[model samples]
Target: MKILNRCTLEFTSIPENVAFARVAVAAFASQLDYTLPELEEIKVAVSEAVGNAIIHGYRNRPDKIVRVNVTIYKEGLEIQVVDSGIGIADIDLAMQPAYSTDPERMGLGFVFMQSFSDRLQVDSSPGKGTTVTMFKQMGLRKARARAN
Candidate 1:
């Protein structure tokens, strides 16, 4: 895919940065003329991906680094959240709804990410951490074309 614009952010795996990542991605996504609801969906999906990296991947270790890559394209927006901490041994089981390792938490991060974005992909190695990549189409062209 051709990238029209791209930015990368690396920050400590702290809970606070989750909101930062969400807002940053939303701001970048705004260039595509997304509706307010669409922007909210992007923010929510980004928060889930980043939060998962902080809580599950790094175990709340503030020293760990989480990276976010945001790319804008004519087709849509592509965002990736990556962490270099403990990775999932069983991706299939991890992706299952309500299958969180933490009993107190409802494991619906993947569900929300999948629902909010046009595409979602999870990649991980047992000791190499995980990467969550998602894409959301602007859908502006179609709407604009319809008005003509």
Candidate 2:
């Protein structure tokens, strides 16, 4: 349903900020009655998204900014992580499992994000950077009704 609240956070693209973003999103999402496992999944998904923005988008440069927006609703939560840096040249190839530009790292970020969230979307331009949007349903209709 209706959006109960929304919050936007912007921070420098640093390694530490990745955890900050993850924790912040998980805390915001905790307003819903998600189980511990679900919360952990959310945190992991958030970490993946934010990490991708920092490691891939900003290339570990602290000068760039990473933006995160979260919307809470009775039915679910929606999150968006964005950065203004080098964007993906091929989204389809990027989404493929085990596909990565970096040779040292495993290309499971998109896979984790997809598995953890109910819906995942990515938008990017060659030089405009990337934005990853994710949604997770609370699946707590009975609980919501009871709370109301």
Which 10 successive residues of model 2 have the least lDDT summed?
138-147
C-alpha lDDT score of every prediction, in listed order: 0.91, 0.91
Q: Compared with the true structure, what per-residue lDDT tens digits does model 2 show for residues 1-148?
A: 6779899999998899989998999999898878889999999999999999988888878899999999998888899999999999999999999998888769999999999999999999989999999999887674477358
Q: How many backbone clashes does candidate 2 have?
A: 0
- Write model 1 residue lDDT over 65-112, tens digit each, in one string: 999999987778999999988999998999899999888889999999
Model 1 deviation from the true structure expressed as Cα RMSD, one decimal place: 2.3
Query: Residue 93 error for model 2, in Å?
Result: 0.4
TM-score, predicted candidate 2 vs. hidden true structure: 0.94
